[model samples]
Target chain A: MSIPARTTEVIGILGGMGPAATADFYAKLVSITPGASDQDHLRTVIWSDPTIPDRTEALLGKGPDPTPWLLDGGRVLREAGATVIAIPCNTAHAFVPRIADHVGLPIVHMIGEVARYLTSLSPRIHTVGLLATAGTVRAGLYQEWLGRSGIHLVLPDNASQDHEVMTAIRKVKAGTRDDTTTALLTRAARRLTARGAQAVIAGCTEIPLGLSADAVDVPLVDPALILARALVSRAGADRTAR
Target chain B: MSIPARTTEVIGILGGMGPAATADFYAKLVSITPGASDQDHLRTVIWSDPTIPDRTEALLGKGPDPTPWLLDGGRVLREAGATVIAIPCNTAHAFVPRIADHVGLPIVHMIGEVARYLTSLSPRIHTVGLLATAGTVRAGLYQEWLGRSGIHLVLPDNASQDHEVMTAIRKVKAGTRDDTTTALLTRAARRLTARGAQAVIAGCTEIPLGLSADAVDVPLVDPALILARALVSRAGADRTAR
Candidate 1:
C-alpha cells in the first residue's frame, strides 16, 4: 500500500441507485471513521443521480441498461478529483464490470469485500442467507463471490421473494418502515434460517433500513455497513502509505 | 420559474465543515423529498472536503483562511454538472459570498432561507434565538439575514457561547451526542428563551443533531432542515419550470 506522500485518497461515491441507501452509506462511513475532528475523516465526492435506470429492472431485461449512467457518474467523480469509487447499491454491482475499467478510477468491489468479510469472521460463517432483489439473484452476484470464499447462500423461494421480500423493499424505498414491512423481512429471514442458514445478509441496501440485526434469530449482516468500513480502512491505509 | 423543457436542475452540496453534518443534511433531504422511488428523487453531487480549515478559527484569526478551499469545492461541484449549489455548513456561509460568483453556479443561501422560513411562520416570530459556532456569530451570517426580515436575534453571552454552545457543537462533531451535550444546548436555549426569544434556531448544523425540537419549550428551528426543504422546493420549481 506504499505510495507517494502527495497521494491523498479521496473516496468517490457513485450512488443513487436509490438515494436513501447512498445517504445511509455515507452516514455509516462518517460514523465509523476513527476521528476526533473533521480533518480526521476522509475527503469524499458523491454523485447521486436517482434517474439512473433501475439496476434490477435492467438485469431482468425489463428496463434499459444503466451502464452509460454509471459510467457518466464515474467520470463525474474522477473529473471532480476522486481517487477511488464506491457504489453503495448491491444490485448495481451486476453492471460494475462493464464500467469499472472505463471509469479509470479503481472501483471497490463491494461484493468481493463482503465475501472477504464473511470469511474473516471468527468461527467463520459457513452458510449465509441472502435477501436481495431478484435481479441480484439472477445475476448470481452473491453466489459467484461467496462461492469463491466457500460460503453457501440460502435464498427465498420465488413466491416468498415476490410477496414478502420485494414488497418489503419497495415499501422501504417509498418511505414506509412500519411493522408490516419489518414483519415481511423478518418472515423471509425466518424461512431462510429454517433452511439451515447460519446468518443472513441484508443483501439489498434498502433491507438494512427495515430489518434490524436483532429482528431475526441469526445475525443479520449489512453489506453497506461493511462496505463503508472497508472504504474507511482503505482510505486510512492509503493516507499513511509512503 | 419558466424554462425550456430540456433544462434540468442538479444540486451541488458544498459540505464537510464536519462530515457528519453534511451526511445529516443529505439524509434529511432524502427523507423529506416527495418520492415513490429512486427516479422521483433529485440529482445531487456532493463535494465534502473535511480538510477545509475550521471556519470559526479563521473568523477568529486563529487559523488559515478557508476561502480558497471553499472556492475549490465550488469549482469541483460546478464542473461535476451541478446547476445550483447548496452549502450545508452554516459557518461556511461566511465565505459563500467570496466564492458564489466565481463558482459559475447559483449558491442557495441557507441563512436567508431560514429567515424567510421564520417570517413565513403563522405566529410571525419577532425574536429568535441562535445557537451557532463563534465564527458564524462573529461573521453575522444570521444577524444580517434575519435583521432584513425584521426578525430580532438573541445571542448567547461570551460565557455561554464558549462553555455551553460551542462545547456542545464540538462534542457532537467528535461523535459524542450524550446527555451532557444535550443538557449544554438545552441550558443555552433556556437562557435565550428567558430573554423573551420566541423560537430558537439550531443555527449551527451540529445543534440539531444534539438538541431535538422537544428539548426546548420554544419551537426549535433547524436551519439544515430548512435548507433541505429550500433545495427541494427550488429543485422541484426548476424541474417543472417549462
Candidate 2:
C-alpha cells in the first residue's frame, strides 16, 4: 500500500449497503492504513442513507425509482465537503452516473476500479465470472468494462442465475447465512466455475458473506476492496501521474 | 409513535459513537415507516464523522479530546435542517448539554428516555444497573439524572468493569463477531445480574452485542431503541397528537 500524500484527503463513503458493510470499510481503512492511532487514518465523511430505494428492486421495477434519493445522497456528501466520493453499494453504481453530475466532487468509480483490477491481475487473466444481482448483470456493467480491455466477462445460465445469486444477495441482506443459504451459494459458485469462468467477481458485496476465499477454489475479486485501494490511491497513497 | 405536527421537525442524530448504529437508525426509518417508497420515511440528516475522538478514549485520557468532533456533529445536523437532534451514541450524550447551546436544534436525550422507560417498568423499582463504558460511568451523566428522581443507579464492581465491555465495543466497531465474543459478553451480563440489579440498561449501544435481555434474568433496556422511539414520536407517529 502506498502512502497517500500528506495533503489531508477527507474521503466520503456513500454507504448504507447493508449498514454492516459500511462499517467494514471504515474498519478496513483502520486496518490497512499506516496510522499510529485512530486519528491517523484518513479523515472521512460518511453519508450512509439506507433510505435510497433498493438498487435491484428499482432496476427490476419491484420498487420505486432511486434517482431522487440517490441524488440526495450525492448532494449530501458533496455539501459535507467530500474531496472525492465513493458509494460502497455494488448495484447502486447503476444510478451513480445520474447523481454524479449533481455532486461537485469527483467519484472514484468502484465498478471501474474492479474492472481495471481484474484486467491488471497478476498474469492478467482473460476471463471473469460475475456473481451479482441480476440488475448489475443485466446492465452489463462488468461486461462493458472488461470488453474495453479485451477481457471476457461471463454470467451463470438463466437456470442458475436469479435463483442462486439473487437468493444469496437477499439472504445476506436479511442477515441470514443458514446452512440452506450456504448450500445455495456453493451451488451457484460451482455453476460459474462450470461455465469456465477463470475468476469470480464477488460483485455483490453480500455474496462474500457465504463464499469466502476458502469456500471456493476460483479467484474471488471483491469490488469493495478494489474500491478501497482506489480510495487509498485517490487519497495520494502513491506518487503517480493522475 | 406520535404523529408529528405539520412542520417538518428536524431530527439531528449526534452520532459517531461508531458509524454503524448511526446508519442502522437511518435504515430502520426506511424499513419500519409506513411509506410506500423512499420519500415517505422521515427526512434525516446524519453526521457520521468517525474521526471524532472516541468519547470513552477522550474522557479516560486514553485518547485526545472528542469535544470538537461532537460539537461538529451538532453543528452539521443543525445546518442540515434538524429542528431537534437525537444523539444515537450513549457515550457522546456527555456533551449534549454543551452541544445544545452551540446548535439551534434542541438535543433529544437518549439517556433520559431510557430513565423514563425504567421508571414506567414498575412502581417498586428504585435501583437500576448501568452496563456502559468507563467513560459513561465516570461521567456520572445517568447517575445525575436518576438522582433527580430520587433513584439509585448501580454500576458493576471494579472486577466486572474494565476493558471487557469496551473491548466488545471495539469488536463491534471492527465489524467482526464470533461465538466466543458472544460468550464473553454473556459472562459479563451474568455478573451484572449478580450485582442485585432488577434490569441492565444496555448502557453502551455496543453492549447489546455482548448482553441481551435473555442473557440475564432481568430486563434489558436498549438506549438506542429509546432514541428511536423518541425520533418516531418527533416525526409524528402519534395519531392522537395529530
Candidate 3:
C-alpha cells in the first residue's frame, strides 16, 4: 500500500454493534495502513456505543429503535474531523442510509464493497451465498446493493434462513458463541453453496469468529475485510497490498 | 461472587485504548457475570476513542493532550446513564482521576482493582512486577494506588522496562504477533517472576495477548481480567448456581 503524502483524511468509525467488532475494525484499519510510527497512520474518531438497542431485535420490534444513538454517533464523527465514515456492524447498516442522510458524511458502504469484490474476483461468478441477519435480509440491504453492482445474490433457503443466519447473529450480539452456532451456520453455508453460490460472504463480522476461511470448501469472503480495505484506501493507504 | 437483591449498577466504559482491550473487557464482563441472558447481565456503555492522544507522548509534550477526549466521554456516559465509569486502557488511568472528578459518577479504578487483587492473592506479595506504559509508570499510577492497597510494587529494571513492554504494545496495536515480540515478553516475564513477584500482572492490556498464562510459568493476572471480574461483581448477576 502506497502512502499518500504520509497521511490521509481522518476516518470515523460508527461502531457499537458490539465492542469486539469495533476493535477488530480499528486493528484492521491500522494493520493495512502504512506507518513508520503510530502517529503516521490516519487519525480515527470512534463512537462505540454498545448500548444501542439491538438492530435485529428492534427491526423485529423486540426492543426500542437504535436510530437515535446511530444518528448521534454520525454527527459526533462529523464534528470530530471524520471526513469519511465506516460502520463495522452489518446489521447497523439498516440505519446507515438514514444516519448518512442526516449526518452528512461519505459512509463507505460495506455491502457495496462486498459486491465490488465479488465482481472483481471472478468474471464467471454469478451468485453468492450471503449469511447475515434477518433484518439485513428482510431489509434487502445486500440484495438491493448487489443488484446495482450487477451480481446475483443467493440467500439461505427460507426454511433455515432465519433460524440459522439470524440466530447466529443474535447469538453473537448476546455474547454467545458455541458449537450450536457453528452447526447452524455451516448448514446454511452448505445450503447456499449447493443452491448456486460460487462463493459465500460471511456478511456479519461476528460470523467469522465461528466460521473461518477453511470451514467451508467454497470461497468465503469477509465483508469486514472489504470495508477495512476500503477504509485503508480512503485513508490514502495503498489498496494493492490488500 | 454473591448477588444482592437489587441489580448491579451499569458501567460506562471510556475505551479505545486501541480496540482489543475493549472487546476483551466486554467478553470478560459476560464471562464473569452470572447472567443467563442479556438483561440478566448489568447494562454497559462503552465509548472507545483511540484517537485520543498517546498518553506517554502527550504528557511529555511530544503530542497533543488527550484529556479533552477523556472528559468528553466521561460527560457522555454521565448523561447517557452510566452509573459508574471505568477505562480499560492502563495508560489512560493517568488522566482518569482528573476525568473522574468532572464526570459526577463513581469511576471504578482499574489500578485500585489491580492493587486489591495483588493484596488478596498474596499478602506477602512485595517487589511485584508490573508491565504498563512508560507514562503509567512515570505517573506512578500503580505505585501510588498500590501503596493505599498495602502492597510493594517493583517495576521492570529500567532498561528492559521501557522498550520491551512499549514495543510489545505497539506490535499488538499494529496487529503483529511475530516471534520477536513473543520472545521479548516471555523473557521479560521470566525476569519479573525471578525478581520475587508472587505473580506478574500484565498491567498493559496489550501485553497479555502476547504473553499468555502458560508462557511465563507464573500466575499471570491480567488487568482486563480483573476489570471484568469487578464488572461482573458490580453487575450484580445471580450467583445462586455458583
Candidate 4:
C-alpha cells in the first residue's frame, strides 16, 4: 500500500495495558505537542483494548500470556494506518519484539527513549534509580537497554518493591491517589537518591500519575513523557524524510 | 457486513476538537467502566485528527465549515467497525446530524444526554445555567434540546460570556490553567447562580477541565462526564440488545 503524503505521521498507540496509564500518556502527548490550532497536531489512532492479559503477572509466571493480545492490538493499529507504534506501558515492552515481528511496524522504544533523554540532559547523568513493577525489574528490560549505554541502574529493594512501589501502582490503577500513596512513593524515591542515583525513572506508567517531580529529591523522569516526545520527533522525521 | 457476537461494543470516538478535551473524555470512559482487569474494559478506537476545522469559529461564522472534516472522521470510524459513534466536543455536536447522515452511524447525543441526566437528578432541576463558548450559546444547541423538556436555560451575561467564559475556554485550549482562569470561571458560575439557576452546566468540554464542581457554589454539572456515562450505558445496551 502506498502511503499518502502528509505533514505528520499517523501514530498508532497500542495501549490499555491499564486504561488510566494510556490516558495519561495521551494527555501528555496532547499537552507537549506545540499546536495552536487542531491541524498542527499529529494524526493518531489508539487501540485501547483493556482485555490484554496483565504483563507483570505474565512476566512473573502468575498469569496467561499477553503476547497474543499485544499482537492483536498491534494488528488493529496497523490496519488503522498507524505508521509507527508506541506502547505506553513499560512492562508491556517485554512483548514488543514479538509483536513487532508479527505486526511489521517500528515501535518507538520507551526505555531507549528514556536512556537517550537522560543522557541528553546537561551534566551527563549516569546513575539512575528505577521505580517500576517487579516484572519489569525481573525481565531486565531497562537493564538491557541502559547497559549498552554504560548507565548504572539502582532499583528499589525487594521489600520496598513488593510493599511500597507495587502497592502504590495498584492503588493508582484502582483510582486511589492520596497522601498515603504520595508518602510511600516519596520514601521510595528518597531511598534511591540516597543510594547515589542522580535521577529516578518513574519507569512504570502508573508511578508518574501519583509521583510528580516535586515529590522526589532527584529528577523524576517519566518514560511515558519521554516516549511521547520521541514519537513526535519520529513522526516529524518521517514527514521530513518523505 | 455482520459484526460477530461480542460482549463489548467497539466505541468510535471522533475526537481532537482541542486534543486535551478528547483525552479527558477518554479518561472518563476508562474510569467509569466497571472492570477488574485489562480485558474487562471496552474496545475503543479513537481517531484523533486535530486537523478538523474549529467548531466554535464555524458556528459563529468566524471560520470555515467543519462538516467535511466531521464527516470524514465519522466515515473513518464507520470503516473501522464502530457500531456506534461519539463526538466528545459539545460544539462539534452542531455538525453531528450532517456527519451522521454521511456515516450512517448512531451518534450518542451529548446535549440530549445532558438533558436526560439533568431530569434524572433528584429535586429535578427545572432551571439550569450553561457556561459554554459564544458559538454554542449563540447556536442555541442546549436551548433547543432543553426546550423540548421544559427546562429553562440561563446563560452568562453578554459581557461575562465575552470576557470570562470565552477567555477561559480559549485559555484551556491553549493548555493554560492558573488562578486567573479559575477566578474567571468561578465568577461566571456565580453569575449563573445569582440568576436563580438551580445548577450550572459546564457545557463546553474545556469548562469542566478548569472549573470543577468545587469551584462554584451551585452544583456544577460536567457535560463531558455526563456524555461519557451516556456512551458507556449506550454501549452496554448495544451488547445486551445484540
Q: List the residue pairs that clash in candidate 1.
A: none
The deviation in Å at residue A134 for candidate 1 is 1.1
**B131-164, model 2: which lDDT tens digit per residue?**
7888898889889887777668778776667646
The digit string of per-residue lDDT tens for model 4 on B1-242 reads 12122355788888988788889999998888765455667778898878787888888888889887777777767776677888888888888777667788888899999988888888888899999988888889999999988999999989999999989888888776778888999999999899899999999888888887887787888888888887777767323321
Please list the residue runs of candidate 1 whose C-alpha ends up more than 4 Å from where it truly belongs after superposition.
Answer: A1-7, A237-242, B1-7, B237-242
Q: Residue B19: error of model 2 in Å?
A: 4.3
Reference-based lDDT, residue B218, model 4: 77
Where is model 4 chain A poorest over a 10-residue stretch in terms of lDDT?
A1-10
Q: Please give the CA lDDT of all the candidate structures.
A: 0.89, 0.69, 0.74, 0.83
Model 4, residue B169: distance off in Å is: 1.1
Chain A TM-score of model 2 comes to 0.91
Q: Which ranges in model 4 have alpha carbons more than 4 Å from their true place?
A: A1-6, A237-242, B1-6, B237-242
What does DockQ give for each predicted structure?
0.59, 0.15, 0.19, 0.50
Best first by TM-score, ranked: 1, 4, 3, 2
Using TM-score as the yardstick, the better of models 1 and 3 is 1
Candidate that would win on lDDT = 1
Model 1: residue A103 alpha-carbon error in angstroms: 0.7
Model 1 residue B120 distance off true place after TM-score fit, in angstroms: 0.9
Which scores higher on DockQ, 1 or 2? 1
- TM-score of the second chain, each candidate in turn, equals 0.94, 0.88, 0.90, 0.94
**How would the docking of model 1 be graded?**
medium
